[model samples]
Target: MRTYFLLCLSIVLAANALSDNLVQAADPAFTHGVASGDPDRESVLLWTRLVSPDSPELELTWELAKDPTMQTILKTGTATARQEHDYCVKVIAADLEPGTTYYYRFRQGNIVSPTGRTRTLPRTAEHIRIGVANCAKYTGGYYHAYDALADTDDLDVIIHLGDYIYENGATRPGDSYYPSFLATGRQHNPPHTCVTLQDYRTRYAQYHQDPELLKLHARYPMIAIWDDHEIAKIPMQKSPSGEPIYDAAWQQRFNDSLQAWHEWIPCRAKQGEVIYRDFQLGSLVNLLMVDTRVCCKSKVDKTEASLKDPNRHIVGDEQLAWLKNSMLTHQATWNIMGNQLLFASKGSDWSRWPGFPTDRNQVIDFLTEHPRINFLITTGNAHNPHHYVVREKESSNILLHEVLPGSISSGNNTEKSRSNPAKLKKLIRAQESNPDLLWYNNDAHGFIVLDLTTQRALVEWYFVTDIRQKQYQVYRAHKLVIDVR
Candidate 1:
């Protein structure tokens, strides 16, 4: 425990002493820390970015060990961090044992990165625990939630739903919802909304400078998918022609943002930029990570005619079909959907699953007919915690459960409810308005933990008391136990 606190303190002090660009430290230093993710039974992806005062590219050796002391080395390899990849190195430590914990670190001469802990997927398991989180904007507040998650020792992996980094400037232009977004004494580097690759990379670097986020990354493997804010909310906008625009400029911007995402996020190499993937944790859990915001989504249309249109799909035909197929193929005690969009409706937000009524009904119908699948859809983007029940074909019989772990630090209704009586009334009225709302919390900064077993699954929400201060307390505010299994 003393060692843990010292490590965290060292990281925070190092972050506090960094320059504006978060660079110019040593000859070749690990400024952003180490992270590992996308683990299979045999391999897990390891990542770290090097900051140098002289060289644009540096060679470093990474070692994975069975113990924390780095005595029993399992895998050792050398990698070159080049300027093209923003000096980020991602390498797969293959031939690892299943369900085994490993420690990894990068070294260049005398410089050594902070040791990161990671675990590969289990070949056979009776239980598993995962942390779920989303919507952490650097300008919104401090990342105490991430620090709290780091303190959780039982987590095997963390699923970042989306909005990992908000691309909005200090002020989001004409959007009245966030006139001056930077209220927590934090600022975005580059001082504008991300557009080009450099802009996105700069934003990611700024977020990386947070000691809490860095500590969380080093402590646990993260499975992440991008939301609208990661790419500057591109899919939400439409041109004057009333049609979704995919012009040349948009394509370039998308490519740039995606490149930055790939550079920063540690994940297994797929065919393309596809992040919608599945992970099987022995026979206990099957995690279906789907992209509902970016890869295959259309502009949001709230009109009744478009809502129920069979052709208008928020998840698109290809991804929806893949989602259903993946569930069918990968059977486990719990089938958890890592959804980026809200599955339940919240006020007039048509961007939820309700926006595509036909597809939503189709998914529910498929789950209903199966009858054997114990399903849970985990989503975010609202920055609020929600618990909802979806019925079987709108019948009395329950079909599936949906949950939002709540946002890490993105701007939520806390200030609005505190300042305005009408907003507070609406928050109260919101729960009263919906019969499916089992629980709702509009004001909080936190993360969720999902524990899965053969008999039941427990989802617990942990909220921090304050994000304005680095030192705060975190408590388990709510818990939902799904015993349908």
Candidate 2:
């Protein structure tokens, strides 16, 4: 641990020096670049941050065009980057055409932000491809996955499953939990777990300045939801062994993190405090995003009764009703369930749906009852990729199909089990015991591409060769096709 921290110290010192130089720059600059997200048929949200003279607020004008060039500007507006909001600007350019692409840029006087491209949801569609990715730890590896994702031209939108930025303490060299942690010369911004609003904002800025992440964000609009790391390991998380830490200032930290999330992430949340919402992708898909990480999850207790308790809700009651209603009500070709946690029961992993069997069965029962819903689920959090034929039990009928894409940068199952024979055996045992688990990759660092058409949906697992270095090659490692009948 001593040597691990020494390496961390060096990376932190180097990063801080670079950060100091950027902070001292004079003229106004769009240091983090531009991004767009929360796309709907008529409008989309555009985002950028400006570094300038330390003023209370700065007004910036934005223009949206249908073309890459600014020759024919479609929409123009102005927004303010206030000091309280960490000098970030977000604007919703509304009343645009459906299924249309728009290019936008922000200008604070002479300094113009990079132009970003975004597209609105279509009213009708025969084919669409959506990219799914999660678990990008800045210290764990290079952002090569993001760079590869930015190059995919066929993708329409991206869904981030969580762990966008880890709130954990600074990573140490040879960190076992992550592959190649701190080998890429990147360290957590504050070099500590985030406990304040500024900490969270600074962490986000660290990620935003990454060229690959900036490139991807500037290209496709993202639909993101938080998982454990968003509020995990920080001011309000449990102890390492899952024991509650009352001194964490839980509520305040939670509030601060969520505030920063709303400010930095380009999401069009439907309610003030709710992140559980659905997006209609023309007639092809209805993307129902739910909050399993934070909406209302009872603390984990290992007792049999506690684990099986109907009252110990992980997804809560109201969200269940909303999920069931949305699943039943949608008329699209596919009702895609988006979760930060896998609804599948991975035997010993109680943090996911398996922890609350009652609620897991409840969701399973609803899907079994409504067979016509044509349900499919995309889950994240696990670094490895997983494919499941979701069911209540081995004998139970199929409830829905679930898929977990490989992490964008986090360590894979192979990395964790490499030196530990028992760990590898445990995963093998779990796989042998669970028949519903069709397949999962023990090793991979990549993303998932979901291709949808009226008759079928195809999940392509694209993986990168290495994350230890900046340059790497990406390839489609696996593919699964689901027939929608």
Candidate 3:
């Protein structure tokens, strides 16, 4: 017993020593960068990860200002970074004016983080601009999409649909990878495969260090949701053991990953809970970010009977209930769903709403019933750009307009650059012919910008020529407007 106790003591001491070393280690600059999310009327959530070797969680302070120079201080507070939180800090600055712009920064013992700018929602929004993006595989290419977003001024908020990070372990070949993908650049990285807290935190650190991502985080207030990649690929609640399907270890890893995610990102998850929450951007829009990967069924086979399963669900019963209640109560001009995966699939190999027809019907029914509601869906998975119109069958009017922003770096519309373009074109055509499906781009590297007013909502798609090249070019643009009755 004494021998066992001695071994345990040794392990504890070694851990403490390692932590102390980490705290004392040279701090990584705001590499992956700064970000803001979950904005309320008077406050917004600010995030930053410190790369110090000796201490992961360092005590830090933050300040909010009314202008770019930060000449006038509005709010200031202190926070700490530790191993539990992957050395990240999230601060909520309150008591500010509604629908106003603010600048913020983090300070740790004179090491000042990059200055970030954010805006709070107004009581009534006359004009608002939103940037939407998803599925950025750092290993695939550069983060020029984010850089372009930073350069394009006048954004009210940035919303990420999902797949903020990839879990594919390594970047596949035939891609010009970015510096952020290199092993050395991964300041905090998952070991072997990320099935643990440390793995998730490390993955976040790796992604956050990319300068382009940091710039966007510094430039705008973001509202984000997590897709399958945040935990594992296409995870469903079907297994009591969960997606990866192993008891003790995988469950612990999932819990740890979630805990670390809450620690690193500007999100509010009360331990073991899912990342399903809602945010209001003044009176202009209601953003409901939902997690469909958890407690849900994976994609079913292509059999007609399976595809028509009445029991399968994507958002599950509880979330669907919450969504119904929320949609009924929403008074905004535009009801935006920050969805993670494509609600309408274009025959991709992945699992999406098509695999769960019953729930899809219910959701469509709800949208149809709420005829007065103008809805927009933003999503990340599919790694391709898609615009679909969910129509109210009886009225023949558009009910929901979905914008699937292509990944900053992920899959493309092309099938290995070898498949018949005509077939893909046919699929695209079918989707567009639907009254609800307006425009879709499966091949591109970019984000979406939405400009909304009380009367109408205008959406613009921004495409980058190539993310593999350090220098990117803009290739395409599309705009759509929805008028609210």
Candidate 4:
């Protein structure tokens, strides 16, 4: 018994020593961890945040390696993390091989941060897989969907369609907006709505603390765009009465939010560039991401006159022209648009593309003119998964496909859809009334997996069994295919 006890004591002592060494080696300066994004053939963007105790400026050393072990360094550089940019460091690592996986890390003195893995865009490939997600509210539930995607090794990139963090406060027992019965232990940090830069930063820190989300960012490069919740519940530059709503205060708040967003997200943007940009994944796909919440002109109104207005602009005139030019010039096999709202024309809810019918129809006309091109629109903010085949009005020919992934942990549509069978039947009948409506499911909460190839693009929808439970199973609920050949 004495011999066994001594052995156990020695083992415990060794374990404690190892743990202390690890703690001593780690750098608490990088509280948010490392991330990489916006990969082209020859370059990619790397990001990290340094927490300075006394110095306003900290020198951070970054290294890129071709292997996960980082034995062979491809590139190394030094960047200054300054207080002007919230102590955030963004470096562009160039001269990288196309379609090659690389690992990166940051160091300051003897402390080192966690390594992040990212890959460059392929110059040419036979197959590419992407993970799509959106509407992740910290207070809604756990981020199991992100965890699942992080564990999967087949995905080439991740496209996030916004609402990354909700600006609202804690949910009480009697809140009518969200399902109070489904509230989890997670809650916002500020305990109030976010309006200033500090408030937004606090909210972001709270959301980034989730291990699943951090793991996902550490594993894959992400392409993101913001929606309503990031700025306001219903963000519009103009009011319903046709007056400018973005006054000085509102503009400042918007600026604050944008600053925080740009600082945290690993995007390929210069100091003054807009977020909308295009990525060419070799000859297989052309990916375009757009911002819809910032420059939109009018508030949502369901009246006939409001819908028929020719001056209404959802993406502004400049972005619209740019989109058209990109569509006309791209020669890839497939064109995928990362949008924030649904494109199908629906009932009086005019906050989506359906509200701006003129611009929407213009895009549809462009798609109709080019029958050989396979256009796929991936959107979020619906909190429900939908598959729609939009078609030309007169000819009834399919123009494009819109795939919407369900929310990460937001309230399910089942409550509203199952309240009354008669009402549900009426809703279904109304949806089927449109010739373009193909599939709709609001009962589940999950993300989507998009598998692209030279022949066809397959969309697989996976749903978490329950959002209330910590440990849940994800099962494939639906699959849709678009022939690209």
Cα lDDT computed for each candidate against the true fold: 0.79, 0.78, 0.69, 0.77
Using TM-score as the measure, what is the rank order of every candidate, best first?
Answer: 1, 2, 4, 3
Q: Please list all clashing residue pairs in model 2, or write none if there are none.
A: none
- Model 3 C-alpha lDDT per residue in residues 179-221, reported as the tens digit of each score: 3345223322453557766677778777765767766776778
**Candidate 4 Cα misplacement greater than 4 A, ranges:** 1-28, 176-183, 239-244, 270-272, 299-302, 415-429, 432-434
Per-candidate TM vs. native? Answer: 0.91, 0.90, 0.83, 0.89
lDDT of 1 by residue, 1-485 (tens): 21322323344234334423346555677878778888888999999998766778889999998777788887999999998899999999999999888889888898777787788888998878899999997776788899889888667789998898888776453443343253455777778778899999999888887878887887788998878888877564443233547778887887788788888888765425668889989988889898876666666666877765666666776787988888888788789999987776665657778777777887887887788889999988878888988766657676778898778877677644544668778677877788778898878889999988888999999999987665799999999999954
Worst 10 residues of 4 by lDDT: 1-10
Residue pairs clashing in model 4 are none
Query: What is the lDDT for 305 in model 1?
Result: 70
- lDDT by residue (1-485, candidate 2, tens digit) is 11211111122123223333454568666777677887889988898887767677888899998766667988999888887878888889999988877778878777667777788988887888899889998877887888788777667789998889888777775566444754566777898899899899989988887877877787789999988787765322343334555645777787788888888888876325778888888888899888876656767778887875667667778889988887667678898877987777766766778777777778877766667778889999888888988764546766678999889877777777777878988887888789888888887888989999999999899899988886799998889988886
Model 1 bad stretches (over 4 Å): 1-22, 171-184, 236-244, 269-272, 347-349, 416-420
Q: TM-score of model 1 relative to the true fold?
A: 0.91
**What shift in Å separates residue 254 of candidate 4 from its native position after superposition?**
1.1
